[model samples]
Target: MSKSKNESNGGITAYSVKTKTKNVPMIDPVIDIKSGRYIATGKDSEGNKMAAILGKAKAEEHIKNGDAKKGTGWD
Candidate 1:
């Protein structure tokens, strides 16, 4: 990205992120496996439900350790 004039002068400017914020659903999603649907359940430190594959246990542990919340809030 090209630097703005203010940036060149050491002045910081706020810019919006280029991606939309995605809200993870609270309910554990049911994935359609060949045998049946698998339901996932877990929460982040802030209590935000995290049911995505590949880090549920570790993320939940982090949440309990301080990286997340409890109940139903977002981090």
Candidate 2:
């Protein structure tokens, strides 16, 4: 199963089933104070999506493409 939660700002958190063998977190993006929206190439300290200075339309496109998951954080 998966879940999500709302952040302080107008951003969201998401979690989904891991891959075939590993229980690793899925490649999902996260909205931040700066940098804006971005996607995950499966690397980084937080492993969160890379931050991008994209517009609303473009950001939505990422979400639609499943590059970014929408909703809340896990409990």
Candidate 3:
């Protein structure tokens, strides 16, 4: 079986403000467009909310490829 994009990329990572950590792996990430910007939101190991800003092209590509779910009420 082929590995999915997220798997190949080692999954999504976000900086954890609460934990004061960098490159923290995100769980159950979802991509959303907020105020004309692309953003990814999920949880950390301790179930703390985490979010990361993503590039426009990258976000659009992920959405188009069905690798990410379109989030509602993200704005």
Candidate 4:
């Protein structure tokens, strides 16, 4: 058996409403801040867009460590 997309890409898991799938791995994940809340957004394997809310500190860490891209309006 082969590794799943998430395992192969080490992507963050996010719920995908479009695919109706839970724990879907996010592709090209980006971190952004909105209304003082941290958000993680990316695409699923099927190319469906997904997003997950994260904590402020955790999001900042990902940005600072270069684990995720800083999305628009993120400073």
Candidate 5:
């Protein structure tokens, strides 16, 4: 998985933020508009692109069920 350099240490990940602690992954993910896979949302710590094997199924399911929509109002 990739982590942005700006990602705060011990801070909440985009995945967790999106799911609002509802059985979500622990990384920032980008949904591929074509394949619907969960790829890394930002650059890795080393500034390279990344994808997480751990979050794919869950993210896909979330997207399919429209759980990816709406805000948790966390911001």
Candidate 6:
């Protein structure tokens, strides 16, 4: 199961601490090619998407089609 807490900035960040095969803290993005981690290029305030991005093919695909949004940089 997952849990959620309120954010001070009035935004909601979802984190699921998995304790199965591995203990994963789902807060920061783990930027490794094998891990397939990614970071958002921040939001396009005027619009509803990011500006541009730099990543591998799959990661780039995520920025384009995944449920990616702005988050604290490289946390």
Of 2 and 4, the candidate ranking higher by TM-score: 4
| Superposed model 4: Cα runs more than 4 Å off | 1-10
Tens-digit lDDT track of model 6 for 1-75: 333231212222222222221222223222223334443333222222222222555344443443344343433
Q: Report the Cα lDDT for candidate 2.
A: 0.37
Runs of candidate 3 exceeding 4 Å displacement = 1-10, 64-67, 73-75
| Better lDDT candidate (2, 6) | 2
- Compared with the true structure, all predictions reach lDDT values of 0.32, 0.37, 0.73, 0.71, 0.37, 0.31
- Kindly list the per-residue Cα lDDT of model 2 for residues 1-75, writing each as its tens digit: 332232212333233223222223334454232334333333223544333333456446556655555433211
Best by lDDT: 3
In candidate 2, how many Å is residue 19 off? 28
The estimated TM-scores of all candidates read: 0.23, 0.32, 0.71, 0.72, 0.27, 0.24
What is the C-alpha lDDT profile of model 1 across 3-74, one tens digit per residue?
432122222122212222233332322222222322234433345444433134433443444433343323
Give the better candidate number (4 or 5) by lDDT. 4
Residues 1-75, candidate 3: write the lDDT tens digits.
764333336466777899998778777779878788778888988999988787777676666766566796343
Candidate closer to the true structure by TM-score (higher is better), 2 or 6 = 2
lDDT ranking of the models: 3, 4, 2, 5, 1, 6
lDDT per residue as tens, model 5, 1-75 = 765432234222343333233222334334443244344343333344433332545544544554343222211
Cα distance off (Å), candidate 1, residue 27? 23
Runs off by more than 4 Å, candidate 2: 1-27, 32-50, 71-75
**Which sections of candidate 5 miss by over 4 Å?**
1-28, 36-41, 53-57, 60-75
> Higher TM-score: candidate 4 or 5?
4
